[model samples]
Target chain A: MPEAFLILILFQLVGSALQTVLHLPVPGPVIGMFLLAAALLWKRSRTRTDKPASSFDSPALSSLSRSLIACLGLLFVPAGVGLVTQMPVLLANGLPIAVALFGSTLLGLMVTAFVMHKATRDRPSPERIPDTGGQVL
Target chain B: MQSLSHTLHQIYARFLPEPNMETLFWLSVTLAVFALGVRLQIRLGRAPWANPVLFAIAFVALGLLITETPYGTYFQSVKIINFLLGPATVALAIPLADSIRLVTRSLPAMTLALLAGSITSVVSGVLLVLLLGGSHDVALSMAPKAVTTPIAIAITTQIGGIPALTAAFAILGGIIAAMIGETTLRRLGITDWRAHGLAAGIAGSGIAAAQVAQRDPVGAAFAALGIGLNGLVTAIIVPLILYFLPG
Candidate 1:
């Protein structure tokens, strides 16, 4: 159980370290998750070919996975509590703060949309009507 | 004598000087708090403005009050949550990576858009605050209101804004952005999940994705990407901007 826990965190650490170093637009956690998934996939593949004609796989990892899934939401508690400790500051700066936040979302949406549209402009939309052969050129 | 004894019990309960538990203690408490967060969401679906983070805040306070636990005792155990947060935050990279094809294809537009989004958010916030004659601290914090917590706090501190104040405002900003996001996107005629998610991630961070996940999982996934990547960008860019912005 402890081994699995350590493995889970180690991949996350690697992902973050890489993100910091590479300056990828991608987040570290996403990378870590991918790495973890890759590792798990690799392990599964390895076990499939080794003494697996009639061997049963380990149940411990499944239980551990279930525990982690169950505890997922709890991870945000500290930051959430940190919010309460800072309320006085919030009430004082509410309006301008609101403007900044809402405004940013709008701006980001516009820019991201423009970017996405431009990127995929050449690729036909999936919703486009297809020809007889199901091709939508 | 009986009444006096009862009063003494109350006093003892309220003012006990002690640390109840260590790291494991706090981690479990945090997990339980998050469980309550899930409960709050389930109880208040449809008009789903109920934020888990907000519930978490209330939960900790209530726990402290009911258990007669001191802040120090709670914090000692709570540090585990903080420690794990760093890794959990790093884990966000997984969702972000899933969008690599979109990212490489749209690099220029995304770059320009990120630059525009970051600058505009800061500029507009500052301008509005100046127009309102808000305090220097208030104005400073508002500048980074759209960014992630780490970047927001840095910008706030550098520009002579209060760091703590910036964090709180960031949360408020995230909640507000998450709230109006879907309706605003539809009204703007923007149907792309990538775009919507990008916007939510940049402006709302994790809080926004949590909300986005309910209505659109794909968008939420992309939003997670946008949050982590752009958070890193904002962290680096905003601080540098402050560094060279004439003081």
Candidate 2:
């Protein structure tokens, strides 16, 4: 578990480094996610025959990941507390901020759902969709 | 009676003394408070608006304010909790990987949905802020309200907004999104799990995703995909919008 955790942190650090070097707009951890996924895919491709399957499926990693996901809500607590500090600003501009936020979110949701439903409404099921590259699911 | 009263006062002073700036003690208190918040949320059947994170923040914030503790001082310990956000976000890859099969099958549609949703979120947020007389800093912060907290903070800072304000708006926007999402989607006749989940994730982030996760894993999977992809899309587009549009 410790080793797997270390690996995750290492990837995040590498991601952070990359973000700093390239000045990418995306967050470090996000880049790390893609890096991890790509690494897993690469490992699967490299040792297709005899590598005792993928290490990403390890129990330790799974458990750590599950725990992290489960307690995900807690991780936002500190920054959420920033609201108290920003209370004055919010109070002064509360009306407009609230209007814009809720309004845009609703608009975004509608546009996304409508566009997605329309675009994929005609596509066949996952099983029937012909595989062109890597495994679909 | 006087001796007993004096003893009680001493005990109260000693036992309930001010929660000093001790790192370990405050750390434990923060975790315990959040754990209690989570338990209450679960007990209340995971009410949409009674979000645990919100409760935790209110509880912690009120405690700090009443105690006259400086936000900066208290953050020394809480920063550890904040740091873990990166690892937790990185851990999101597990679910993203799990859903890759479905994602790859409908790659074009999913990408289109993400782009469309992300663009709408940014354009609408920024435009509304400007139209409603918000400052440029507020506009920059509001632009990333749809993204998750960590990424939203980074984006807001990069675009010269108040990072703390962006953090607050991110959670506020997410909760508000979760509150109105279901009724709005149903009214629009969006019954498909994939479409509904994608909308929730794109607009609401983690809180909305959790709500979807309770009812349908497939929906949750798509929502997770939306969360990650939307984060990436917003990160790219917000800067461009700021540069080109300059609103």
Highest-lDDT candidate: 2
Q: What are the per-residue Cα lDDT tens digits for candidate 2 across A1-137?
A: 98769867988999999999999988888889778777765665676565576665566766787688777778888777877777887777877798898899889889999998889855432322222221111
Candidate 1 chain A TM is: 0.52
**Which candidate ranks first by TM-score, i.e. highest?**
2
lDDT of each: 0.59, 0.79
Listed models, DockQ each:
0.21, 0.41
Worst 10 residues of 1 chain A by lDDT: A128-137
Using all chains and alpha carbons, the TM-scores for the candidates as numbered come to: 0.69, 0.89
Candidate 1 Cα misplacement greater than 4 A, ranges? A1-76, A83-88, A114-137, B1-18, B21-30, B62-73, B148-163, B244-247
**lDDT per residue as tens, model 2, B196-232:** 7898889988888777777666677888888888988
Chain B TM-score for the candidates in order: 0.78, 0.89
Model 1, position B229: C-alpha lDDT score: 63
Q: Scoring only the second chain, what is candidate 2's TM-score?
A: 0.89
lDDT (tens digit, per residue) of candidate 1 on B1-247:
5576566547645664344634555566666676676676666752346766566767776665555555666666676655564455433433444456666765676676666666666666666676655656676667677765644553455557766566666666777777887677778776766666667777676566556655555565567666666665665566565554432
